[model samples]
Target: MTDTTAGTPAATDGGDPPDGSDFGVGEEGSDDPRIEFRGGKWASTLPLVFFIAWAIFQSGVLGIGDTNGLVVGALVGTTLGMFLVRGDWKAYADTIFEGMTQRVAATAIVAWLWAGMFAQTLQAGGFVEGLIFAADALNVGASTFPAAAFILCGLLATGIGTGYGATVAFVTLVFPAGVLIGANPVLLFAAILSGAVFGDNLAPVSDTTIVSAVTQDADIGGVVASRFKYAIAAAVPAFAAYLIAGSAMAGVSLEGAVALRESANALGLVHLLSMGVVIVTAVVGRHIVEAISWGLVVAVASNLLFGLSSASDIVAFTVTEAGALSGLPVVEVGETAGVGGSLYTGAVGFFPLIVLTLLIVAMAQIMIRGGGFEAIQTFLLDRVATTVRRAELTMVLGTATINGMITINTAAEIAIAPYVARIGEKFNINGYRRANILDANTSALGYIFPWAGGVLVGYQVMVGPDGLGSQYGPEMVVNPIEVVPYVFHGWFLVAIFIIAAITGFGREYIPDRASEEVSRA
Candidate 1:
C-alpha cells in the first residue's frame, strides 16, 4: 500500500492531527522514517508553475485579457496538480474540500453579507451624490484636473475600502466630465486604477489588508504601518504621471461648466457626517460590517429628521414597486414615490460579488485537490529558494502568480497564505514585514492582470461597446489591451519589490534568536 501523506514528511509530533487524522487522510502509513521523497514539495509547486505560464500566455502572448482565460488557467493547473500527487484520488479530494470550506468559503460568505449591507446603505444614504457635489464644487483648468481627480478618487477609495466600487464611481462621475472638457481618457482611467491600487494596499478595512495581517499573525496596525512606505513609493510616481497626462490633453471649455459647478456646490454638505461615521469606526478597529451598519442608521435618521430628503422620498428609497415590498404599496413621495431602499441597492450591488467569490473558492478547491498547490510549494522551497532572500522573492512572485489565475485578490492571498507564513517563519522574517509584502503585491497585481475581476469590471465600464467608449469613442478610455502597455505603475511597484529583495532594504524585526527558539503558538 502507498503512503498517501508521502509527499510532505511532517511528523505530527507527539500527537495525532486535531481531527484525529487528516480528514480521514489515506489509511496507508509508511514507517520507513527516512527522508523519503513522498512527493509533497514538487507536488505542491506544479500548480504554481502552471498558473505562472498560463497567466503569461493569456495576458502576454495570446492577449486574451478576460475571465475566460482565467477559467482555462484554473483547469490546466488543477489537472497538473492531480498528476503530481501520490495518493488515492479520494484523499486528495478530501484535503482540498477541507481547505476550501475552512478558509475561502467561510471568509467569502461573511464578506458578502457585510458587503451587501454596506454597499446598499451607502447608496441609500446618498454618498454618491455627496461625491458628485464635491466634484462639481471644483472648477479647475484642464491642466490640473487630472491630478485633482486622481487624488480625490484615491481618497474616496481609501475611505470605502473597495477599489472596484471606487472605479465604477470615478468612471461614471469623473470620466465623463473629463472627456467633455477634453481630458485624456487613457490617463484618466489609469489615474482611477492608480487611486484604487493605493486604497487596496493601504485601507485598514481592505480585504487584502485583513488577509495579510491575519495570515501572517500580525496586528493590522503594524501591517499598515510597515507597508506605508512601499505604497507611497509606487503611488507618487503614478500620481505624477496622471498630472502630466492631464496637462497634455487638450479640451474646449463648455457653457454649462458653470452649471456643473453649481450642482457640486449645492450638495457639498449633504450629510457628509454619515461618511465620517464609517471612516472613524473602521479606524478604531471595529468590525467593518458593524461599522457600516451604524453608518447606515445614522444616514437614514439624518436624511429624515435633518430634511436631507423628504420623509416620503426616504420611504420610497426602501421599497421600489418592482420589488417584493413594492407590490404592497406604501405612501407616495413629493409626487409619485419611486421604489427605494438599502435592501434593494445592497442586493443588486453585492449579488455579482457573492457569485464571484463562490466560484473562485470552488476553483481554488479544485486546484488544491488536484495537488497543484503542494506541487509548487515544494519545488520552490527545496530547489530555487535555497536562501532567505530567495524565499521572500518566491513569496512575492507566488502571490502575484496566484492572483493572476484566481482573479479575486483576497482569495489568492488566502490560497497562498499558509505557504507564505511557513516560509517566512523558517527564515525568521518579521511577521509585520511578511504581512506587508503579501498585501502590497496582492493589491498591485490583482488589478493589473486582465483576468482580474477588478480589471474586467473596470474595463467593461470604461471601454465596453455601449460603455463610455461609445459616447467618446477611443479618445475617452483606452481598450484593456492598450491599457496593459501603459500600466507603468504596476510595473514600477513590481520593480520596487524586486529591488528590495536584492538589496535587503527596509528590513524590519527578524524574530531574534531568542524569539526563534521559542515554539510557534
Candidate 2:
C-alpha cells in the first residue's frame, strides 16, 4: 500500500545518493555525468520508445492483452538499446540492475504480491457472493451496480493506499458479481478503474502521495491536505457521471442472474471484517505487509470458522495418486493436480507483471543514466518553460507524457520527479503545488491507458484459466480496450490539473507558504 520510509534517504533503492540528494538535476555549475550514446541523447530513449511501440501494437492494434507478451517486448527493447551504446557496455548493463533494485520497483512488486494473496483469500471466502446477497436484499440492480461499485472500490483503495491492490481485489471479487447482476461489463470495469484513480490520487498513504511529497521536499500531511480540493472537485463530478452512465448503458443479459442472486448467502459477508482489519491497521500506521497479513489471517479464520470455505479450498497440495500427505485436509490425490489454491494462484498471477515492471524500470534507468531525462529537461526549461504559467503547464504535460509512456505510475512519478522539482523551484512554486502536479498526472494516466499497470492488472484477472471467464462465463470478461474511455475519474483528474495549470486554480507560490521539513510518516 504505502511506505512510510519513502521520504527518507534509506528509501533510495540505489537511485539517489546515500545522503538522499536528488538525481537528474546536478548542483549549480556542475555537469551531471551521462553515458554516451552513439546517436546522442535522443538515442538513449530507444528502450522505452521501442517498448511503447510494442505495447501499442500488441495491446492497442492487435488487441492482445498479454502481460507476458509485454514482458517479452520490454526485454527485447532493453537488449536492442544495448547495441546502440557508444562504448562501455558494462555501464549500460549495470544500469539495468540499478533500475530493478530501485525502491519504487520493489514497493510495487511487494504490494501486488500481498494484495494478490489477500484478494484471493477474500474470494475464497465468498466475498463476491456476499456482495451479491447484499445487493439483492437491497434491490441494487444492473442500473445501479456500476455506481455502487465505483464508490465501494474507491473506499477500499483509499483505505488500502494502493490502487493496484484495490483493482486486483475488486476485479477478483466485484467485477464478476457486477456482470452477473447484469451491469454493463465494460462500464463496470471502467468504474473499478475510476475508483482506483480516485484513491490513488487522494489517499494519504498511497505510494504516489509518498513519492510526490518526498520528491518535492514537502511534508506528506501538507501535500495531502492541499490536494483534497482538487481530488474532491474531480470526484464529485465523476461519481455523478457514473450514476448517469450506469442508467444509460445497456447491461449484459445473463440467464443465471436471478439464480446466482438467489444462491448467494449473507454469511459470506463476514469477510468484510477481514477487509476492515487491513484498512484499519494500514490507516493506523502499521506496515502494509503487516496489515495484509492480518487480513489474510482473519479471512482464513473466517472461512473455516463460519464454514464459508474448507481448508483444502483455501490452499491444497495435490498429487497424481494417493500419498501419505493425502490424509491431511489440504492434501489430495487427483487425476490432474499439483500445488493449487488461493495463495499460490493469487501470488503467481502477478509474476508476469512483476517481470514487466522490472524490465521497464531498467529501461528507465538507462534513460536516466544516458542523459535522456536531462536532455528533455533542458529543452523544456530553455524553449518551453520560460514563464511561471508555462513552467506549471510544462510540469503537467511533462508528467502526463512520462506516465503515458510508463505502465507503472509510481515508477513514472519517480523518473519525472526531479524535473518537476527543478521546473517548479525555478519559478518559486510551492512544494505542495509541485507534488500535487507531479502525482495527479502520475495517478490518472497510469489507469487510463489500455496498457497501463492498473488496467493490465485488472485485465489479467478476467481472461485467464482461473479468472472470471472460467467462473461466470466469457461474457463476464471486459477487454481493457473497451474500458479505456470510461475511466471517468482518471480523465477528469488530468483535465482538472490541465485547467489548474492554465487558470491558476489552487495555485500557490513558495512565498504563499513554506512547507515543513520532509519526514517519514
Candidate 3:
C-alpha cells in the first residue's frame, strides 16, 4: 500500500528464497592470443584505475549526480586507456568491441529492456495506486507506519524488481504520509531504503542478480534460492529496528498527508496476476528475458482490458515539438517528433544504463587481459587470502571496498565480478558463496552511501517539483546524509555477509553439492 510500483521486475520464480551465497574464462593451458592481455599487469590496470578515480571525483566530490555523465566519462577515460595498449590500436579496439558484445553483458541488458517495458505498463495499470488505497484503508499511525511501510515497500520492490523505483515511489508517496503521521524523517528514509535492499537482493529479475548469476556462471533460479536465508536473517532485525524506531521517534504533526486513496482504482489490483506469471515463470526455470517478456505482454493486455490506459497510450509514439527526436527518422526538415506511453519510454529509460554496463564490462575485459586481474589475485591469495576463511573474508572485504568507491551498484558489480570468480575459484569456493559475497556488498553499499544510485533517485523524487518539498515545504525533504545512520537493513546485510564468511553460516562448494534449482519448467 505504500504506492510505489513503477518498478523493476524484482525477482524470477522463487522456489522460496535463504542464506546466500562468474566470470566466464577458458582453459588455463591455452595460449590463445585472444585470451591474453597485450600489456603488463600494471599497464592493464590503468583504465580501471582511471575509471575509479573519475567515479570518486564525479559522484563523491563534484556531486554531478548524472549517471549518463559517468558513462561519458567512462567513454573518454577508456579511450585514453587505449593509448596504453602497447601494440596495434586495431587489437585494442577489437578487444573493446568484443567486450561490448559479449553475452554476459547482453543478457542483463536484454532482461532490463523487457523489465522496463513491463514495469511501465504495470504502472499505467495503477498497481501502486491500489497500494495507496490499501494503506489508507489500514489507517496506520506514526508508531506503526515505518514498520508497515517497510513491509509494503519490500513486497512492492519484490514485485517491481527495482529498489530505485521503490525508493522513489515510497519517498514520493509514503514518506509524506509517514511524516504527516509523525514518523522521524531519517527513519522514514531508512525504511524506504531497507525495503529497496530487500527487493534488490532477493528479486530474481534484478540486474544485480542477473549479473551475479551470469558473471559467475550460475543459473538465476539457483542464485535466488541459495541467497534467501541471508536476506531473511538481515530483514528480521531490520524490521524490528524499524518497529522500535517508529515508536521511539513518534510525534504529533498538525499537517495532514495529501490523500492518495482517492486516486486508486480497484481494477488495478489484477496486475498482481501479471506479477504472478513473472514469478512462476522464473521459479520454474525459464529464461529471465523470456519470463519478463511474458510479463510485459500481460501488463499491456491488462492495461487495455482493465481500462487502466488506452491503446494510444500504450504506443503513443507521436511526433511532437516539446521533446526532441535524434535517433528516430520520423523527423521532417523542420518537424521534430518524440515518443510517449508505456512501451517506448519504458524500454528507452534503460538504454544509457545498458550501454554503460557494456562499456564497463569492456574495461573489465581489458583488466583481465592485461594481467591486472591476476596481479590482484596474486596479492590477495599470497598475503591476505591465505586460508578458506581468510579467502572468504577477503572476498567480502574486497567486494565492499570496490562498492564503496563506485556509485552505481550494478556497474560496480560488473566491474568486480571477474575478480570474484577468479579468486573464489582458487579456494574452490562455491559459486553461490562467491556470488553472495559479490552481490551482498554490491546491493548493500549502493543504498547506504549518500551518492549511491538508489539513495540519489529517492532524494531526487523528494526534492523534485511535485515532490514532498513542493507539496509541503523544504523541511520535509530528507537529506541523503541524514538517512545513512538509519539505513539498518543495508548495514545489517553487509555485517551478515561478513559474519557468514567468518563463521561459515551458509557457505557451500560446487561439485560437492549442486545448488537448489527449480524442479519444473
Global lDDT of each candidate: 0.59, 0.86, 0.70
User: lDDT tens digits, residues 213-309, model 3?
Assistant: 7666566778888899999999999999988888897544434344544565567677777767876676565666676678778888888887887
Candidate 2 deviates by what RMSD? 5.5
Best of the candidates, lDDT: 2
> Mind giving the per-residue lDDT tens digits that candidate 2 earns over 1-521?
64222333323233332112332222311336457898988898999999999999999888888999999999999999999998789988988997787777888898899999899989998999998888888998888888898888888888888999999999999887888887899999999998998888877778888888887878778998999999898888888998899999998877677788787989989999998999899888777888889999999999999998889887998888897778999998898878888998899999999999999888888887888888898999999999988999999999999998899998888888889988999998988999999988999999988889999999899876598878778788777888888999988888999899999999988766666767554
Question: Candidate 3: worst 10 consecutive residues by lDDT?
Answer: 20-29
Minimal lDDT window, size 10, model 2: 20-29
Runs in model 2 deviating more than 4 A are: 1-31
Which residue segments of model 3 deviate by more than 4 Å? Answer: 1-40, 141-146, 152-193, 203-226, 246-268, 317-336, 406-432, 450-486, 507-521
Query: lDDT (0-100) at residue 500 of candidate 1?
Result: 80
Extract clashing residue pairs from model 2: none
Model 1 deviation from the true structure expressed as Cα RMSD, one decimal place: 9.0
